[model samples]
Target: MWANLALSPLHVAAGTSVGNGALLGLTRLVSLKLAELRITDGDCAGIAALTRLTELDLRNSRVGDAGVQGLSRLTSLQCLDLTWTQASSPPALSSLTKLNMDNCKVGGEVALRVLRSTRFPKLHAVHMSMVQVDETGRELLNAICSDSASTLDSFMLPSASISTVRFIGRAVALRSLDLTGVKITDSSWGTLAMLVSLQELELRGTNASNEVIKSLQDLVQLQRLSLRQTRINDGALPLLQSLQGGLTSLDLSDNDIQGEPALQQAWGNLQLLESLQLLKTKVTDAGAHSLKQLGASLRELHIGSTDLSNACFLRACEKLQILHLDGCRKLTAPVFQSGVRHLQELQALTVSDCPFISKAAVLEVQKDLPLRYMSCDDEVLFSAKKTEPIWKSGAALTDRLQELAPYDERCRYSTDELLSARYSEFVPQLESSGPLAAVLRELELVSTQ
Candidate 1:
């Protein structure tokens, strides 16, 4: 019987090869990911036998034309990534849906073969960047652009030209766009305004200006927006507010988002927001206070490198599960003691580069450790080291409880928290003893009832 298997996101070493005999039992593979490495011709020929392959990623590798040519027989292949490879000729694949050949040597001849609408009608997304194409290639590129604009729902190309954007700007069906890597200095930045159907947009580290920001206000369907490392300023508040009702997550990190007015102006109305990132901004105490309006809707916050005071945690909404306080110079241990206690839902916390917070200080504040993961004082920490050993076997835990002359309040509190969180509360199959274990059994029975 053939097993359902998929080996993915695999980084191969240089000169990685596998003979057909070596893969004796693996008559076929579900997927082969040989990205950023060199595979021999023998390996390429051997890989051609994998007719069952559905996904293949060959990004940034030394895969030659012969290696990619062998994949033509893989009729079931759905997604193919040939980014930054030397493969020039890609055979017409009938089942391929997505093709990423960014920074490849595909010229006019290859474009005519792959981009032609007559051959691979199933192709939906065509991602290409920095491809040197001849005059014939340019003509075929226009045809592909026209075809992709009318039918394709997703088109992503960081190296896409201005003309390509103009063509796809008419794509009313496009939903997800990752043009963050595109450096648009002209009206091309404004072209995104036409994509009203877009549900996700990432413009991180791009040259988009205030005018370009205004252009995106019409994208009401957007649920996720990333404007990190951009020239975001107070002028974009109205635009943000326009999308506030629909946005669930937004990243405004690494920008010149100074003062509280910028946040207060637009963020107070974003009650539906579940996650927000403002790392490396100059947000003040009042700016953070605006987040309190979100209440329980806010779940994750990244407020690193801000000038906020100790009250930052108190104002960051109490229901946060993930919090990052790295590079927070103004905050001290008292913030954790006072504000973090209210954050019972917090599972992950990072306080790296904090001048005052030490590992010892965090441990001293803890009675029953609740954090599943924590990073502080340049050391990585996990809750398993402190609590998981006890949870491994409930019988052993019952023995430890019996030895106790008096039950420590901390022990009781932490155990209750673990039970409530349901991460490590019981081992039902294993038998437990002792009076404490009996009490736990009764508690579990009652809780279940």
Candidate 2:
């Protein structure tokens, strides 16, 4: 029920109790969200009074067709989200610029009827994820695409078929396209590659082939492309090499591109890549070395659940800001000594599941070079949980160690003097022992002093 006297975004979710009087009073409200609530058709009636409302989100609400009818009076509304809600039948919303009706109970026919009736000259974005569509729904979608293809900038649909995808291609003005759950194969790639204006394209879980994917090299304007969980391989990557200079973000995570040869080929290019994700992929130390080429341009990098060892971190990626080495089992103390210590620009580092790294070592490194966020496997300073009986007893052992007595007066001498004195004291005692033993004992004595 909180809002300023002027226009602002108001979000109220999780079935929070909001009275009608408070909702009706926000006449100047620009955006109002009432998601996951008990709001019904009657509650929506109060919203009709907010004539200036430009954005409304009623996702996961109990609103039905009647509630949608009540919102028809909101002439100034531009963006409306009815995701995971019972509301299906929408009124003619000519002013809407963005509409999201994902996972709604309504059939595509009713939704399309509303869409077909509405004139969205300025509408640019629409997301209908997980919504079932019939043949009639497909026709309506085609008709809607035909109507708004010139103006639409973004469109995301989960169950797009090849025909529906080709129809969507008519949206020449589109800059972003997300077809995550679509069944489009190599046949549809030709139609998709025609979207030369696309800046961001996501084909996650698609059946796109390497040859079909490389055809998108014509999209020189493309910046962010995600082929995660696709059929693309190493050979197909070189086709995408045309985009190496302009592409800023690439997500090839969760693919079958195994070994260093394939990974090396992928990383050999892309000098301007700012973010890269290679989680759950098989890559060895040799492949990890390929990342050194990116160096300063690489800002955010994730290499989780890989076969990379400490040698992977030897690369001088000095400008790296965020690094994720989660589930890299071979990584150990050398990660801190040889790799992390040198990355001066690192802000956040995640080393979870790296069993060889200890919490104490991480704390010491952080003390030397402070970081904004640091994550490890366990809550304690050590990677593994403490199993010692004393630790289980939960005594004030750590506090006692912090309050231990100072060094002896004789130990106040310089480190070099202490080492020289300790060598003199322990050298004769270990003279009969091997030279290695004598040297070890002398070093231990110096350390104790």
Candidate 3:
């Protein structure tokens, strides 16, 4: 039965008896992925016989304590993904090379014990999000990294309340590190700069300032760096410019970086830069032109929420592939006709919220370019055809009731009359405004309803 087993989603749900019948006829089963199944303690008996299984993914399944106990028998298992399951005491996963338990109920001593006890000789990547990994946990992880040598490469511990900075100097072999939503002091940044082998680093939602940017200059091997929602400003640009020769992708999105001088000084040296995102930044047409200077190697560019005209985007039309100009209400048709027509590789173009762009301009671009995807008014618009309906007929009545729920005191009419009203006080205003304006109108109407 084991030799004839064909792993599928249907086979796992039919019960372990059916799986055991299939496993009995199999000789070599390398991978077994039971993702999003309702497997219970009884199903563990079927997995115990899969000694030759190398990869196993039991993510989003009801694998309780008994199910984990059964997993201990499979000594040949290399990769295990038990993400989002309810198991406080995880079974010893010594043979696993990659383990993922992100957003699980496991916490405190039990979480640290799993990391401490698991003797994974080949373990490289570990994803343990929403776990309580404090100072002592960092110490244990440091020991693991020091012992693993070159094997440990990727570590994602986002939402793991890591207040102290203890494991920075120890994890030298780490290539990709995601420290999003972690609380780290200035000293932590200095310690992290010492890890010379780091390639990809994400400090999104962290309190890292411009001072830490100088320390990051030492990480010459870093290729992709995301500083979204950080306190970095113009002062940090020079330090980033130092890594121009090696760095390829840079994200400064959601930062309060004002003016064009910092961008010009930093990006001027980045001859190999391909992807750059300035989403929600205060960059204007001047800043957009400064970025266009790096057009030789630039492929993907996002300058969302800025007051940029289509002319600013036309500057780098040749190499641009994915361009997001969302929330740029000032963009006109002339910017597209003159510049965007040259971009042969342009696949995805977003022109959301720019009411100035006439329907004729959109049709012209669609006719001239090879754009596979385009979005306007949150609806797909391409090839001079509108495929889907934007709003349902009875949606207006339902929306009016929801809007009036918060401020029923202000309305003189009854709930039944408001629901049945052909022309409610909110309906006319919602129809006139755009999507974002409509949402704001509803909030205002609720207060007066």
Ranking by lDDT: 2, 3, 1
TM-score (all chains, Cα) for each model: 0.69, 0.71, 0.74
The residue-by-residue lDDT of candidate 3 on 286-361, one tens digit each, is 7676666677887777666556674654556478776666566777778755777878787666665667776567
Q: Which is the better candidate, 1 or 3, if ranked by lDDT?
A: 3
Q: What is the lDDT of residue 295 in candidate 3?
A: 76
lDDT of 1 at 186: 52
Please list the C-alpha lDDT of all candidates, in the order they appear. 0.61, 0.64, 0.63
**What does the lDDT read for residue 375 in candidate 1?**
60
Q: Which sections of candidate 1 miss by over 4 Å? A: 1-61, 65-77, 88-90, 102-109, 112-120, 124-145, 149-154, 159-164, 262-269, 312-316, 385-449
TM-score for model 2?
Answer: 0.71
Q: Give lDDT tens digits, candidate 2, residues 332-385.
A: 776655788877787666666777877666666675444655656634332211
Candidate 1 vs candidate 3: the TM-score winner is 3
TM-score of 1: 0.69
Report the lDDT tens digits of candidate 1 across residue range 1-449.
43334444233443676455644345457766665556544566666677777877776667767677676877888888787678764556767777777666665565565655334445567666555445555554445545456455666554434333555565556787766456664566667778888887767667666677677776778777788778877566666776533778787888877546645464544577887777788877766776776766888777765477665535457787767676677777877567776777776666666687778666653454467666665455444332322244443343233222122222343343434532223321111212244445544432221
**Candidate 3: segments with Cα more than 4 A from true spot:** 1-28, 88-90, 106-118, 134-140, 263-268, 342-345, 383-449
